[model samples]
Target: MDLLHHFPHARQRPLRELLAEKQTWVNQDKKGFLRYRALLNELRHIRATWLDLNSDVVHIGRPSDLSPADRVHLQAALCSLKPWRKGPFSVFGIEIDAEWRSERKWNRLIPELPDLSGKIVADIGSNNGYYMFRMAFHHPTLVLGFEPYVHHYYTFNLLNSFAGLSNLQNTLLGIEHLSLFPESFDVIFCMGILYHRPSPIESLQALHVALKPGGSIIVESQAIPGEEPVALFPEHTYAKVPGTWFVPTATCLQHWMQRAGFHNIRCFCAHEMSSEEQRQTPWMEFESFQDFIDKDNPGLTIEGYPAPRRVFFAANKN
Candidate 1:
């Protein structure tokens, strides 16, 4: 599929330029690209008879649609993309119970979501397009997902190929690329991405620049427990995740949005993370939240840091 064709005409030229630069970096690992190409080639042949995005488990096709041999082939193809991080998708009767029960998080945010009908939306760090697929039910004019990892980018493409959600599109891009989309989006979902950035405030600033006037940004992040407006700059890793940087208090996160020039900032939800929310599963059999936290004390991580908590906030551009 010509991914560029899905983008708006006004963005086509600059997006082309940006993708060309990205291609240069991608080309450095020709073998990995070849592997991804082979995977996509294998996936294109399998098509879903029907799909339902509105369900808790995003359902695609049914068992009756595929022969026994075809089901085996499909399962093998999906298993190749291991460590599924953000989903509980059922594709053609084969269940993919991913590491995170993403539906739980989705349910928390849905009540607070702005009406998305005909709006242009962006989901930053949209791993495997789980949220993007869910957002499709809202009848958005367009829902573009930005996920930089090649594994996830291809996974989303493969799923969409069968589900065929015309309004849902994805790109091999991350939050750093938000500058290319100045004032282009009506709503941006920046979930589970802020704490990963070394400079959280600057990342929020980029999100601010990407929104149209009066646009809203919904931010969900790993936060520390406290009422004080301060952040925990981890000396090393937080919850055994090395990429984590500043785990902020709920108040501190709101303050970050305020500093980023967002107005009417409101924190709608705040809750501690749990094994039930994220854990090892058949589809994602690896070290999970259970292994990261202290068995003796759930309130603290294995590294002795405050245990993981996720906080959700919504703010608007002036």
Candidate 2:
């Protein structure tokens, strides 16, 4: 008998919840889906708190002022998503700062990151050369960063010049241009950047060609954590806002990875955070989140902030 038949009620509630959630999410109007907007609201609130207290706290752009086109660009940046500045570490444009950390820091994810020394790696959509700077310092790898923004290119290059980080190279091209290359990299990172494009899957396919058959790619994305994802663009917000295809679940991420011809996929969440870290870090803006959740779901007690966010998925091109 099918294992699913053995436990008939196993997926019933989750399935029902997911279906209803999707329906409601799709029905949301203008401002944004109740769910995602809540996440943003809490983030904004936390950001305000952080800025008031922490003098050195880094902040990205505000979402409200974004044009529909810019919103899509922001989605691609995954720029709005968190884990923002990798804890204030720097040197030689390389992070010699003690705060710099690897996936190893987030024990909940069980990230199997390899030593970057001496391998050829591709940093797709390298915003501000954050990853490039880090890898340039510790891992002896030849890292190439592809970023389309001119200002970022200039700033990153200037930093590279000052730090004299020979291991890192910056380019002003989109991942779609990967077709120009015939060789493969030892590793490719597509972090927080795919959602902006009209074709995230196509971007994935482009990476497949850019990678060695067995090379791996790190995919970090913003997705609806519980139930199902709610679409913000289709419902409203702005006329030119591009839709963010939130994976909605770990399984959904696995599906996308599989379709991209990646193998041996792994996934994880941030919710497995330590208790103190969860409560102490004010970024877990629950009060503001509750307000938005309450607006869309008055009868429900869905506290949004601090909810598990953005899934981490990785797999090999093989």
Best candidate per TM-score, number?
1
lDDT of 1 by residue, 161-258 (tens): 88878888887889998877778889999999999999999999999998988988899999999999999888888888899899999999998899
What lDDT does candidate 1 reach at residue 185? Answer: 88
Give the TM-score of each candidate: 0.94, 0.55
Q: Which stretches of candidate 1 lie over 4 Å from their true place?
A: 1-14, 23-29
TM-score of 2: 0.55
How big is the positional error of residue 240 in model 1, measured in Å on the Cα after superposition?
0.9
What is the C-alpha local distance difference test score of each model? 0.87, 0.50
User: Once superposed on the true structure, which residue ranges of model 2 sit more than 4 Å away at CA?
Assistant: 1-110, 227-248, 270-308
Write down the RMSD of candidate 2 (Cα, Å). 17.8
Determine which window of 10 residues in candidate 2 has minimal summed lDDT.
Answer: 46-55
